[model samples]
Target: MPPTKLAFFRYLLIDEMLRSRSRPFPTKEEILEACNEKFGVNSISTIEKDMAAMRLDFDAPIYYDKRQKGYAYQDPEYKFLSVNLSEDEMLALSFVETLLGEFRNMPIFSLFSVAVDKVLDGLELTKKLHTEKRHLQQAIQIEQAPYLKGSDKLGDLLRYIAEQKVIEVSYQKYGSESTKDYLVHPYLLKEFRNMWYLIGYHEASGEVRTFGIDRITQVLPQEKDFLPQEKVNFDAESFYFYCIGVTALSEKPAEIRLRFEPFLANYVKAQPLHHTQEIIEDDEQKGCLLRLRLIINHELKMLILGYGAGVCVEAPASLAAEIRREFEKGVAQYATKN
Candidate 1:
């Protein structure tokens, strides 16, 4: 039979079986009547042939119950339609699996794996089909950050933040010898380039701070609640808009400008460095200059260095000087030692 005719027959046969579900026993005439009006067919031979074909193709356990003199599903667990995949679906499944496999240690990987399994199971795909499609090619690529090292303390900080609990943490601030004890109301957890940070409101200091998770030597959950004064009206995106890196200092943002080489200009243009990034000057011949109103922080400096000679900071004299000092320090490392 042609594809269209086969499809029509399958639709009618399935419809008849579904209608029989609620009833104790439905006669062939009744099943035929329900489908014949919709399909414009009344031949018993045609109906029988379609039902037999459906049973064979779908592997459905449908049979005629002799005592009831009506057709019934032999296996109660079997569904009318197998959630089997077409070629396209199998290819999509295979591609996603490969991409997820790259991030094997990520917390979300197991959840994604379980979800893929559920979808495949629903489609009635055999293990062979799944295995055969594993080699399917993936076009898009995502580069995940290197696995975090020396930060077993991050998991605990993340748990406290998720639970909305106050934590007493011992943090060694950069350049500070003494470890400061803080009663912080955890606001958010951030991971930037493998380094993790907890953004919270420090009660004793009466200030919002970003504490690197790696610097946290100890984390103790405090029973005392540390709710913000006005329920932290800060929107996370807007608050982090002009951050030098992940540390969005509680200072007014400045209009910071940076120049990029022609080759790197297009790459920067395609992706925004900050929520408020905009192109102030773009001359392919002279290179491109982009402006963003964000804090000048170490995180942003590292990002600029990642592009090496392709990018430069054109900013507050202080920021430019800092970059120069960093390059000089790096150069000093290569000098001959007496």
Candidate 2:
């Protein structure tokens, strides 16, 4: 029979006792007393049966030492949960732990460190070996924005999301001197370009709105309960389906076609701008034509602008004109004085 939750916990306790360096081997009576204290009272016969199960089922190298007058592992290094990881896999795990360093300053993901440490401990990676593997962090650095604002609000917002609470927020938009109050039923917390945003149902507007976390001055106490999920009807996937970045300004998505220079086309093919992105045409002389169905927002515009002269918007004459105007403005700026 498979072990019950209580049975598994008893097995763990027994394993710890067997592996104890200072106490060494422990008597059946001692093991029973410890298990009984934690779980319900278990008899000495139960301990014997548990050890037998450990030996048979788990292949635990458990034996009774006559000299010590107690039960012990024949293999001192034996663990109930043995995790065998390849050297490469171990290094990858270490690299993942290092990647989490991006959120080290954020309190919301603090448990991630503890969880990774537990896995490393289970793998029995020596301190020196683990430290050496961590050198990969220095070799492959993850770029993180220094001193991100509103990071401290992550923990509280996460808690509110879990509890399904409605919150009142004091917000000030960029370049706006005035601060406004909002009653929001926060649904999802999204991150884009190292900045955080709260996607929620705005009670006053009776529609969904996106609020930048950095712009939020305060989250007031819960004056009202959250609206029913059915009433809110917020589907994060559907909401973001046609959207690029945080803003979903339009109800319908535009079919955007773009042409990239040959060299830049290779990079775009490898790392696509959107999930709906498709290579419509590619040629040695003509370059590449890419198609994307997306809502043309500030982020998409900025991304296209970042590519400079390498990319050209082919379809959507309005968007193409907008890009042309932007480029013309840039050229005009350069034509004049600095």
**Which structure among the candidates has the greatest lDDT?**
2
How many angstroms is residue 230 displaced in model 2 relative to the true structure, after the best TM-score fit?
4.0
Which clashing pairs does model 1 show?
83-123, 84-123, 242-294
Q: Check candidate 2 and list the clashing pairs.
A: none
For model 2, the superposed segments whose C-alpha errors exceed 4 Å read 1-3, 16-26, 37-42, 65-69, 72-78, 126-129, 220-223
Q: Mind giving the per-residue lDDT tens digits that candidate 2 earns over 15-94?
A: 99999988988999899999889887578999998999899989999999999999898987777887777878777787
lDDT (0-100) at residue 337 of candidate 1?
A: 60
> What lDDT would candidate 2 get against the real structure?
0.86
**True-vs-predicted CA distance for residue 77, candidate 1, Å:** 6.9
Candidate 1 stretches with Cα past 4 Å from truth are 1-94, 106-112, 119-129, 136-145, 150-159, 170-181, 226-233, 331-338
Residue 252 accuracy (lDDT) in model 2? 84
